[model samples]
Target: MKELINKYYQNHSLIYKVLLFLITTAVIVYFFPKGGKFKYNLQKGKPWQYENLYAPFDFSIQKSPEELNAEKEEIEKSKQLFFLVKEEVKAEVIESYNKKVDFILKDSLALKMNKARLKNFGEKFINNVYKVGFLNKADNSKIQSNQLITLRLGNEASDILSDNLFTTDELVSSIQQYFTNSSYESLENNFTSLFFEILEPNVFYDEELTNRALEEELKNRSFTKGFVAENERIISKGDMVDASKYEILDSLKKEYDTQLWSKSSYNWIVVGYTILVALVLVMLFLFLKKYRLEIFHNNTKLTFILFNIVLFVFLVTIVQKYFVGYLYVVPIIILPIVLKAFFDARLGLFTHVLTVLLLGFIVPNSFEFVFLQIIAGMVTILTVSELHRRANLFVSILKITLIYTVAYLAFSIIQNGSEQKIQWVYFGMFALNGVLSFLSLFLILIYEKSFGLVSDVSLLELSDTNSTLLRELNEKAPGTFQHSMQVANLAEASANEIGANAMLVRAGALYHDIGKMLNPMYFTENQTTSVSPHHDLSPTDSAKIIRDHVIKGIEMAKKNGLPDRLIDFIRTHHGTNTIYYFYKMQSELTPDQVNIEDFKYPGPIPFSKETAILMMCDSCEAASKSLKTPTALLIDELVEKVINTQMSQGQFMNSDITFKEIQTIKKVIKKKLHNIYHLRIEYPE
Candidate 1:
């Protein structure tokens, strides 16, 4: 299984690329919402751009959420509540009242007649109370109107009661009237006092029945305000889309969108989507191939770039399905920021544009969406060019957010001719997007570690001399470390002149000679005294020791988890060139035949301008130190000799460095070296 996996990854052939393309296409298509997109883009309050729009079929104009909510509020405010009369509750109250009357009769012997008389009075009092009806405090508050409400006693019988039916004043008055007709008028006050304690609401609000009725009524309320018949001209071109016109146009758009998926064939939609995605991907690949061929050839880099694009596009699509209004919160500018951090600005902008174009299909108002994203992407590329500094990212995100808001506001005004139509939440989302874009700083580090990729931020960290490896290099081989620093300066200058990656070359030059730390004294730079270690070894052995540093450097770099890009500097600095000193010594001793392979440094020559420039810098710097009484002329001679020798040996043939760039590099080296080795004259006093 391991071998199969290895074989699968070992060859990046046409089959592999085809498989990648197919899988990418499948993943993207799976995330897409199941619907056909409306062809014409329209917005509320905007002037119509296309010709006259007509309804293709009879469709209802659906109410907006705001309108539906308003209708619901009205229903809640005016809807009547039902109350069910519990006859058993009246019976329970009357039994309790009779028991209370018995207690009262026991206490008031002077005024009471027989128990039957008191019980009859209590029953009469309870009957009068039930006639008025009872409602809870909450239900009583809901009836604002003074009109009567109906109370249902049974399926066939009911009564209408005033809104003030259950007031305390009415309860006492009814009790007084019941006793006033009796002989126990004196007992009326005592009985009325007893009735207050036992009184409870028999008319309970039937919430379930009331809610059921309300729902039925709400269902009768039409969700559609009106209808447009088939072949009706909705709006003409150049017509201002007012609220009513916008509503009709919006209704037509929604109906057309729905019918596009349901009534029309979806097979063609799938085909169209597939073709569009393929074309965009193909364009991205071709752009990389023509301009950034190195990234194109590198499968990891290409996958990283494509993965970011697809991931963001998928996220945008999902957000469109749910939070369509806050689409600006997706932070599409993160694509350009991440790409520009890892790669160049040109590739970043191109990838961003293609990603935006794909998203345009899924979003409403394609022109505005595409316009804002493209402009924000441009701002990201131009402002966030250097992501090493935290301040740069902050400033860049602020500018990107400002551009998004301004562009969106401008589009909103063009549509509505007023700022009131703008959605403030979208502006807040743009600000949140700026804050969220800061996450890419950490994401940059994650991608660097995951994909074996490097960014300027990582390069800046690696350039610190206090790092463990660099400090170790200083402790073991201070002279060699100093030489590496000098080479780094030269290489960075030359790279900048030639438009190569200056940061990468600078980092590479610093760690290029780390292998020499393994045996510092053997190298001449770290030798403290006149006594040389090479004296004890033969010329072939000494050359072998020198050549092994490159191999050792690579091994140590791997052990320490250094990236391959930096290791390339260690591998190619010597460019298979001979170690001339030891080789000449061996030739003088033998004078016969010596194998060239033993004398040459193991190398797969420099393949980039940075590495090639480092090679020249390393050779010229090291050789220039050997010149006694160095003059400007001598430094110039040395620079030309070293670079010209490397060029003649075809060390730079594999690199993309042009002859003109090489000339520029040579001139830079001469000037820098002359400044370092300028002739000084002693003055006599």
Candidate 2:
């Protein structure tokens, strides 16, 4: 069941693919116009409905012939009404003048009989008869009946009477006359004059009742004004070109009928979109195949890639949607970063290219932009290609900045024909982006460490010269330090021969025997005073201490933050092989209770080429010390015997070591051992 699950994840199983397909389908479906409304609306030219319906009204200047004619007719009608009313008022005024003259004369005579003065009686009688107030004025006696009745009334009353009678009558009569006696043409002329007179008081000919009659006349002609009002509201065809002016309610209805219901080009667009999505999924599947073996044990690659792809696509889509006009170049910068974090530089370059191609399809006017992106991406990939240190990552960012700057300027010049004036600005922005990339690299490193990726750069950092644990080993167990140095040299050389990571092997060698610092005297290498600590101890006790070093090394390593790879080399270098001479001597004297297997070193054996080489080197170094004459034959025999012993004991069973690699290792070790134990020349005295 576990193997099946492993294989499923390894092959990027249908479950994950289906999940991705469903998610992508959901996203595309959600954004796709429902019921073909958008397409139907588009086909029916109803794009205006999509515009904001609540937009502010735009002010504009406009004029129309109907508007002008309606306005003129309204004004003319007002004028005609004003003139007819004026005529009727004038006739009434003439009759009232004659009657008023006769009444005034009779009242004057009656006033004289009542003992009132002639002038006072005449004024009072006129005031009573006309039912009007008299104004203060000189020559009051002139108010009597005369040939023309030259009354000495105040100008207020006279003006009021003249305006109320003549102007009001003229206005009413003119309107009525326009409707009654005049031909249509004449009536139109009168109506226009009357309308102007009433509606526009300044344009009216009658000055007598201009203030009072004009307001009333305009009120009566409101129906004509309404026609002019319609003309005022009639929107011109040019005005309808505005999207807001389009009736949204009507447009929405049409869109539902035409665009939503219509099946047209949008179906093809959806088909193309789905195919693109499938292509992305396929590409992701292919890219993940490289980790098939690794993912069998760890699904980190799958998890990381899925996370980045989803995150990147979402971010790029957002940038494309909201920031429509501006170029969103973050994908160009982020693609290399994400790939470098999840995989390596080679894969990062591939991802960069893919991102550029994908984004080009999304962004408007993306040709030159995509070209710039490609240049930047390539530079970014090159910058981080062989990064084995954090400092190298930073330096790579600087290089990336320089490359991007040059590329951006060159592209800008080619595309827009812009001068070099803003090149420094571009350089500054490029440098800023490089800084961000460096920060992103740091973040990835932190995340990788958190997840225990154990990149080569981290390994190098852990193996630095000033490593505190190594320094402690040098101080506490000088003999073990010397031993580790020798082992490091031997293991590094052997690893190099076998095309393994020589530095890693060397570093692992340096820290391999650190457990000896706990009880340094028990080991022969650290016993400088000629007193062997194990001489008084039993073989079993001595073997126990010897075996304990492997276990002890692991504890000390954990305390010092040493990685698992180093600890593995420490533990497995002596792979459950017996302390042969001691165990054999004990076997001669002891019973079956003291089993030889109990004296053996506990190990799962070397699982890697480097560890296996270290194991062979450890045994070969110890055995070589016993040889008086270190010749090629002795060194060759010792190397072969140690390797063959370990191999026969099944110590190399689980390792990737082959016979060919073992032969190479033997040759290298023989040469090194021979050099170390070479015979010194006698003095020539």
Candidate 3:
């Protein structure tokens, strides 16, 4: 039982990996739509490639969105506007007019006119004008075409031509003619102004009632004008899918997705989703295990990758359910951009394609959506390869947006065969997608902070010599600072030649020797006077101090908050190789008492191509400074000896760097050294 527990304890990490894989698969599967996928790839312009297609169940043929929108637009144009006539307003106006006339006659200069006849004619005119109804000015501007409005007077309603109604202007004309035929032309102008001021539009636009009636009409609007019985042949093989046939196929697909499945079939559907989603995630895991073993072994990085996929799938799935129109605007392109920033383009594009394929099942028009997104993902990977460069960052974003828009445009035109028929809203979606893709920059910063991982952007920031830690290193140990800079250049060039992360290696190289600052004078490079610190110390003490630099560097780096990745270079730059000078001297004096382990630098060795390159560059750069009169040949020999010695000592055994890559790095170092020494090529005749 004890042995069994120990065995389980030893394999806990592997078990954790298995659990992570299962959880990722389950989460992705849960994001899938709980419906069966339609079996056919339906395209409107393409010929039917399958055998005679038939409806398996009875379903109404749904009208196309364009058709439904056209119907609604007709209703908007031809709907009747209802107006109510207030019968009480007529009586109110007459009483108010009589009061005004009585008061005006007592003070008027024209009191010789028959006041009773004047009041009677004005009352008669008001009844004639307010008979039909007058429209308010606000509603008049809405309808420019011929309008037939419904006028309601209490419980009675009647349809009347809008031209028959009297506007305020028409009332003026009628009043002029009435007075021309009467004996009251003396007060015509004054009464005309009074009539205009006293009268209000009795027949108002019944906006509330009109809207309710419109809603009732719209609610009764039929989405389907026809229905197809079960087993009806929809289309035959090799038949062109015209508009009518396309509508039938689309309607059938919608029914297939929405119709309730039987208990057994639903369970089967869920099982199918599980198997497919699990397979995709399995492929991702296998890819990481095979190609990116370092990341596969590190659970933090593995979780980071998995978390990104799940987060995007969740966001896109929610959008698919709630805001279906904004599906394209969900910014799926950001997946590739973020992955490329943290990892490599190849992995980014691969995982992006996988993620888009998973989403293909959720979004409608799966083929077109998957095709467009895969292309966009590839474009993202290609352009965002150098996201650390601020100039190239916007350029990449613009290129990604342009590619997505142009591709979507071309696909739309090809599918519809008419640019006018293309749904222009998708163009806005694509533009907004581009805008949202810029969020990848902020997302990267968030991931860095959350996951304790580093990206090229962070590496670039750390690479700046003016940073606090680097500035202190320069002030305290200028010689070590200069050495680190030279080593950084060499490591960067070597990394570029071997297709490693140049920025990462450069950052690693810069902070690798920070421990030398603690005891700067002990190192030969910082010794300005003719005296040496090691002269007063014994060989054992000297070796101990020299080896303590790696330990001290790691402590200082952790204290200052450097990433574990950069700290690795400080730990492994010298590997476990011995400080041979002090070791040899100690052994010569006390062969029996000298301990080899005490002389060795504590190291786990360089465990990656970047760290291995730093080790080689560090050793070669320091050794190069010792040459009294250097030549290209001697520099070449020095690089070969240093790297080969480290190689024979198994320093690069765990680094995963190949022999060819090592040879290439050596050649780069030799050439760079020759240039630094100003060695000109011997061009002989």
Query: Which candidate tops TM-score?
Result: 3
Candidate 1 on 69-156: residue-level lDDT in tens? 8999999776767778887888888778866766777765524477776677677767766777766656666565575555767874
How do the residues 317-417 of candidate 2 rate in per-residue lDDT, one tens digit apiece?
66667764334335346667656644456567766676566555555445555777777778776666435656777776777667776766665554333
Candidate 1: pairs in clash: none
CA deviation > 4 Å runs, candidate 1: 1-11, 44-46, 102-129, 141-152, 156-162, 168-192, 321-328, 385-395, 411-417, 431-435, 466-477, 490-503, 515-556, 571-685
Identify the superior model by TM-score, candidate 1 or candidate 2. 1
Note the clash tally of each candidate: 0, 43, 0
Give each model a TM-score: 0.77, 0.47, 0.82
User: What Cα-based lDDT does every candidate model obtain?
Assistant: 0.84, 0.59, 0.87
User: Looking at candidate 3, what is the lDDT of residue 22?
Assistant: 89
Of models 1 and 3, which has the larger lDDT? 3
Give the 10-residue window scoring lowest on summed lDDT in candidate 3.
Answer: 257-266
